[model samples]
Target: MKLLAGLTILMIVFVVFGIHTQQQILGLASDMQEMVPNISREINNENWDAARNDTARLLEQWNEIQDRWDLFIVHSEIEQVELYIARILSYLSSEDKAAALAELAALNTQLSHIYRKEMFNVQNIF
Candidate 1:
C-alpha cells in the first residue's frame, strides 16, 4: 500500500512537470515568433538598419533562452534557429533582401515546428 501511494504521487509530479515544460516551450517559441514578422516587414520596406537591429535583438533573445530551451527541446532545433539567424544577419549586412526574407521564413517555420513538436497532443503521445 505504501509503495502504491508513492508511485501515484510520483506519477502526479511527472504529469505536472510535463505540463509546465510544455507551457515554457510554447511561451518561448511564441516570443520568438512575434519578432520574426517585424524583421520580415523591415526587410520588405528595405529598412536595412532597422532589420539589422531587430535581427540582433532576436539573436539576443535566442541566446538568453537557449539553455532553458535545451532543457526541453532537441539541440538540433536550436542549432537550426542559430543557423538561420546567422544567415539572416549575413544577408542583412549585404542588403540582400531576398535572401534575408527567405531565411526569416525558414526561421519562422523552424520555431513553429519546435513548439508544435513539443505540444502534448495525441500525435506526440503515440
Candidate 2:
C-alpha cells in the first residue's frame, strides 16, 4: 500500500537525521581534541605566550560549537567543559604553567566524554 511505503520513507528519513546529528556532534568534538597536542607542546616548551594564544583560539572554537550542540546534548556536560576552559584561562593569567597544563588535560577528558556520550552506540542510547 502507498500508506505503508510512505511510512517507511518517513522512518528512514528520521533515522538518517539522527545519525547525521550524531556525526556533526562528534565532528565538533574531534576538532577540539585535535588542539590538545599543540597546546600540550606549547606548555612543555614553556612557550607561555603561544600557549595562551592557542588556548584563546581553542575557547573560541568551543563557543562556536557550543550552541549547535546544546540542542542535541546535555547542558551540564557542556558547562563542565566551559568551566575547565575558565580554569585554564585563570592559570594562564597567573603564569602558572603546571596548573594550566593540568586544566588542559582535564579539558581534553571532558571533550572526550562529550564525544563518547554522543556516539551512536547501544550503551549511549539507553
Candidate 3:
C-alpha cells in the first residue's frame, strides 16, 4: 500500500538524519579537542593573554556549532558548555590559573558527554 511505502520512507529518513546528527556532533567535538593542546600550553606558560585569546576563539567556534546543534541536542547540554566557557573566562580575568584549568577540564567532559550521549551505543539506546 502507499501508506506502508510512505512509512518505510519516513523511517529511512529518520535513520539518515540521526546518523548525520551524530557525525556533526562528533566533528564539533573533534574541532574543540584539536585546540586543547594550544590552550593547555598557554595556560601552563602563564600566558594569560594568549590563553584568553585562544579560549575566546574556542568559545566562538562552540557558539557557531551550538546554533546548529540546538536543533538536535538537548538545551541543557549546550548550556553546560556555555556556562563552563563563561566560568573559564571569569577565572582568566581573575588570574586564577588553577580554577581556569579545572573549568577547562569540566568543559572537556561536557563535550565528551554530548558526543557519547548521541552515540548509537546500547547504553544510550536502552
Candidate 4:
C-alpha cells in the first residue's frame, strides 16, 4: 500500500514538471505570433524584398542540378519537370516553391515507371 502511494506521488510530480516545461517552450513561440501580423502587413507592401534574395539563393542550388537527362528519350516527363523547376525558381513567392516541389515529386514517380518500361524494352530487343 505504501508503494502504491509513493508511485502516485511520483507520477503527480512528473506531470507537474512536464506541464511546466511545455509552458516554457510555448512561451518562446508566443511572442512570434504577436510579431507576425505586423510583419505580414509590411510584407504585403512589397517589403518582401528579402524574400527575393532568398529566391536567388534557391535558384543557385537549383542551377546545380545539371539537365544531363534533358535528352533522355526514356523519360521526357522528368525532363519536363527539370525545365519547369528551372523556370519556377525565377519566382520569389512561396506558392510557386510548393507547387514546383509537388510537381517534381510526381514527375519522379512517372519517370520511375518510364524507366522500368524502358529497361524491359531494351532487354527484349536484344
Highest-scoring model, lDDT: 1
Pairs in steric clash, model 4 = none
Reference-based TM-score, model 2: 0.87
Candidate 2 whole-model C-alpha lDDT, 0 to 1: 0.89
lDDT of 2 at 88: 85
Q: Write the per-residue lDDT of candidate 4 for residues 84-109, one digit (tens) a residue.
A: 44543443255344453444344344
- Lowest lDDT 10-residue stretch of candidate 2: 117-126
Which consecutive 10 residues in model 1 have the weakest lDDT in total? 68-77
1-126, model 3: which lDDT tens digit per residue?
999999999999999998898888898897897787787778889999999999999999988888899998889989999999999889998889899999988988888888788889899979
A best-first ranking of the candidates according to their lDDT comes to 1, 2, 3, 4
| Best-matching candidate per TM-score | 3
User: Judged by lDDT against the true structure, how good is candidate 3?
Assistant: 0.89
Better of 2 and 4 by lDDT: 2
Clashing pairs in 3: none
TM-score per candidate: 0.93, 0.87, 0.94, 0.34
- After aligning candidate 1 to the native by TM-score, how far in Å is the CA of 92 from where it should be? 0.5
**Model 1 stretches astray by more than 4 angstroms:** none
- Predictions in order: lDDT: 0.94, 0.89, 0.89, 0.45
Cα miss at 57, model 1 (Å)? 0.8
| RMSD per model, one decimal | 1.3, 2.1, 1.1, 19.0
lDDT of candidate 1 over 1-126, digit per residue (tens): 999999999999999998998898899899999999899999999999999999999999999989888876779989999999999999999999999999999999999999889998999889
